[model samples]
Target chain A: MILQKISKQGKGELAFAGSLFLLGIFVAWDTSKMVIPQGSSIVSPQTFPYMVAAFTSLVGLVLISDVLRGRLGTPDGAEPGDPFIAPSYKTMAILMAAIGLHVILLEIAGYVVSATICFFGVSFAFGSRKYLKDFAVSLIFALTVYFSFTKGLNINLPAGFFEGVFGK
Target chain B: MGNSFSMLMDGFQTAFTPTNLMFGLLGTFLGTLVGVLPGIGPALAIGLLLPICLTVNPTSALIMFAAIYYGAMYGGSTTSILLNTPGESGSVITALEGNKMAKAGRAGAALATAAIGSFVAGTIATLLLAFGAPALADLALTIQPAGYLALIILAFATVGTLLGESRIRGLVALAVGLVIGLVGADLQSGALRLTFGNLNAIDGIETVTVIVAIFALGEALYLASRHTLVNVEVLTMSGKAWMTREDFKRSWKPWLRGTAIGFPLGVIPAGGSEVPTFLSYGVEKAISKNKDEFGKGAIEGVAGPEAANNANAAGVLVPMLALGLPTSATAAVVLVAFQSFNIQPGPMLFQTNPEIVWGLIASLFIGNTLLLVLNLPLIRFWVLLLKIPSHYLYAGITTFALLGAYALNNSTFDLQVALVVGFIGYLFRRFGVPITPLIIGVILGPLAELYFKRALQISQGDWHILIAGPFPKIIYSILLLVIIGPMVWNFKKKFANKK
Candidate 1:
């Protein structure tokens, strides 16, 4: 049973290392495809990319060897007594989805609206049950930031829905 | 010396303007608030604010940003004392004795010592920065492209070694950052390398976007995902803010010693508050008169480490200001802030924009004084921040993170990039890959490439030119030693064990 758990951990690390190795290969392949224009600078752009690709591949190999040797990069418990607990996938997924939705809706729905929704979504993901309070807080917070950025700082945020109302 | 002194005076004139002072105050207050909050350090605070600050004047923006960095350093100890939860890694040592002191009803003394110690250390370190940076910049001005490339390589080595548990993981994280940095069109050839045919990819990813994603959004998501598991209980403050005379006597020496130890370590490439703090703790434990109180709430433990932590934070700025090299994660974000203002930090920074450079150094003094005032008399007010619910705080952080990314270029594409990078940041955190190297990589990768290519151009594309210079040779030798020193020691240890 112990052996199985150890191997599982090894496999997990191996998967990460393998992906990294593949990424290195992809970088090398992609860099090769880049065409250097004639009369460009003395050194081609490919040189640095090639070096990076080679370095990445070498490091990937090193990581694989290190993992296979049963060496894992363990957290050193800098904050003693506070053992690291991996975050749940459900919460991460929900939060990630919420952020993605915010990004997609940001220009379409506008900053204030998307931000409010994102805030509430995140609050909910973190197990906040007070819907009304969260909603009120999110709205006020988003609106305040919106005005501060646009009016005070003069950075034009996307006023998609509010453009007509704000006379933009 | 006279020139630097007068330059600092000019810096003070700029830093002390009413508007700049107000910004400094705001930054300090905000920095302290975030610093007192669990899991929200200066790096996240700066990342969240970087976009907003971009809209403000460069000098004022940097003044506020510098204030936030110092303020966070001060505020981290508040949580360490009051809740045993350190808001930053540097404050972990303080919590060891600080929380114990709180439990024993000496929380006020611990809190006062930490604040006062930080002020003293901060002031001393700022003085060192004021004096040291100019001299270092003068030296840096003479370094050629090859030497600069070597220095960058040295930075990679030191950051990789110091940041993570394993050098391999650190290097991997750095390489990942280098790849991310290389995604835009190559400046030399104007050839697109890794854009993948997206119009938004042509400009390359903004530093602000990467910073917000990794430090702010990534950290928030991680915290939110683990929200249910980590229960933070705040300890109520009970005593007066004033410390006893005996407490003062015990703390002063440690404060000075910590400053002495922390400043040099901070200036070195192995830049972090953690090492100096642990060293301070050990040194204090060794020399304390009340040795019996070492584990169970020694005041010296709080005083020394807190001082060391703050001094170390200040120390980190020296290399950053002088060399355009960020020694710590927070400094890396600040480096991006410099870029946002079109102010490149390095030897030329001092020569070109002495106002910004010296003004920032001068503002550290102002920020430190403001932090001392805010922390001491208003300790109760700051303690209330601990009572804020984790859900609301983290939710607010993520919302601002998204907004900040969007505000960078008013593009949803940047937000999407932030989200993607944030996810990568989350994975980096989960896997125990040190994120600092990745940040440093993203910030320094282009510069390293620029220098490397410049060196090659100068040498007519000969690789041996990289090591031809005495400076580059020395730097290469140091890199070799740093990489192989541990392996040799470990091998020797194994052989000795066999005997």
Candidate 2:
């Protein structure tokens, strides 16, 4: 009875494997377009990516077979536990949007401004209500970083509008 | 010995400079803060600072780096005791007994022993470094690749034996890491192997990104999902911070033994402090007059492991200075720092720059003293760190991680890579895979591959050359036992039982 109940539960791994297989095939095909003629003894740059694509597909295949054979199913005689559910699509969408927006803003605002804003904003997302503390900490972190790296250690960071204004 | 003493005196002169002392204090303070917080290890801190370390005078810069290392070691025990969370791998062992002590209302004693033991070990180990480094350096210079390879094999065996609940699982984790490491660029052919068409992946995944993603971020996500937050009660202390005479009587011997064991092992390649702590714990369990107190809150267990952890931390520096080999992930980042200074870490380093070498050694003694002063009297201050709301703490950690990633190259692309790796790390954690081995493989993978290929090339592809020299043969023999010996013993036992 328990085994039957377990078998009827979610198949997240199978679905995940299927999605990965498709992603691999698509990426591999797109990458093949960037390949150019290469000299002997030097494999085309596409070779590595293609190999990865192949490996991913192979792993996907094994995963699919395992799912089919019910090997991916929770073991028999195991005590009842919650079914493994996949991540919510809404959460995935939020993560993607945050990353996309961050990337778009990176070059325009430069590191100092962009990093400060992102750090504060991200903290707010994680349920931080203390804006004053957040702003103060983030700014201090950014400024200290600016001084430590720019003045003390001497590494050059990206310079935006405030570049010379900050004495960079 | 005379030259070493004189060299240390010169080092003391350099390290005592106002600027170096200030930097050491600053690094230790920051490192302790970061180490107290879960999901932030010294590696991430050093990586974030590597670009900046390039500009400073190497000696002062190194003083700060060493300070950060000592701070992290001390800071790691805080979270382990207070929240049952280990901020770094070394602290995991602490969590085993520390949390138990906390539950039993002996949090103060646990914290006190850990701090004092660390101080003792750090002091003794630093002194050892001062006296023994020159001789070790002279010895290391004569070591050929064969001997070095053997040392690496021994380290591998130790890690394999010590990690994971089951040896099978540990080996599986190690093998998985090795496979992932082999996925990237093939150095000999200049051919990328597993980038999967992403231009970003052409450089392969940075070890820092992989480690942070897998261990730190992944741990966060895992904990978040479970929502199994333990409401750890703060234990108020009863007496003065000083240890009782009985406590001293029990702790002194273990402290010395831990130092003795940890120092020698620290010089081995891949000989991280984690193994020595475990070994010390086992030895203490066997030898302690008060063995029943173990796991139930033994002060000796706390003292020995904590001492071993710190002593091993110092011991590992010998090779890091002499041969430029890093035994732990944190040391690997430091190796990168050395390279950023355009200084290769090997035997020639001492010849070319005695000031930087000896100065850094002297600074460690000073840093340890500083850590001891800061750690003990400030236990209450550290405990207050736990009072910060969990939501805010997590948010701050995530924000720092994101900013750190962005600060590296000022590319949002890297941030996205960190995120993806973080999510992937979450998945790996959800599965049964251990992440440390993966990081170990990634960091050491290229080096191992490079050496293996060079050794092979020098032999014109003769595979036997790997086993030609006595050193290599000895190393291989140990590696062979590490790889196959357990399985054989298991099989033999199973058959014997059947018969």
Q: Which has the greatest TM-score?
A: 1
User: Which regions in candidate 1 have their CA more than 4 angstroms from the true location?
Assistant: A1-10, A75-87, B484-499
- What C-alpha lDDT, on a 0 to 100 scale, does residue B137 get in candidate 1? 91
Q: Largest lDDT belongs to which candidate?
A: 1
Model 2 CA lDDT for position B27: 77
Residue pairs in clash, model 1 = none
Q: Each model's DockQ?
A: 0.58, 0.19
| Global Cα RMSD, each model | 3.6, 6.2
Model 2 per-residue lDDT at B160: 48
TM-score for each candidate, following the candidate numbering: 0.93, 0.79
Sum up the clashes in candidate 2. Answer: 0
Q: Going through the candidates in order, what is chain B's TM-score?
A: 0.94, 0.87
Best by DockQ: 1
Candidate 2 TM-score on chain B:
0.87
Question: For residues B402-499, what per-residue lDDT tens digits would candidate 1 score against the true structure?
Answer: 88888777787898889888977776765567777887788889889999999999988888888886999998898888777546434322322232
- What are the per-residue Cα lDDT tens digits for candidate 2 across B1-499? 9888888899999999899999888878877877776545566656554544445688888888888888887888777876766666566668778778777877777888888888899899988877776777787787665466556556555554444333433333444444455444556565655566667666666555555555545555554544443445545554545577787888889889989888887876433666677778878989978777888888887888889988988887877787666667677777766765678777778888899888888888888889888887877777787776664565456545665566555556677677776765655555433445555555555656556556655676666776786767767776766666556435422422231
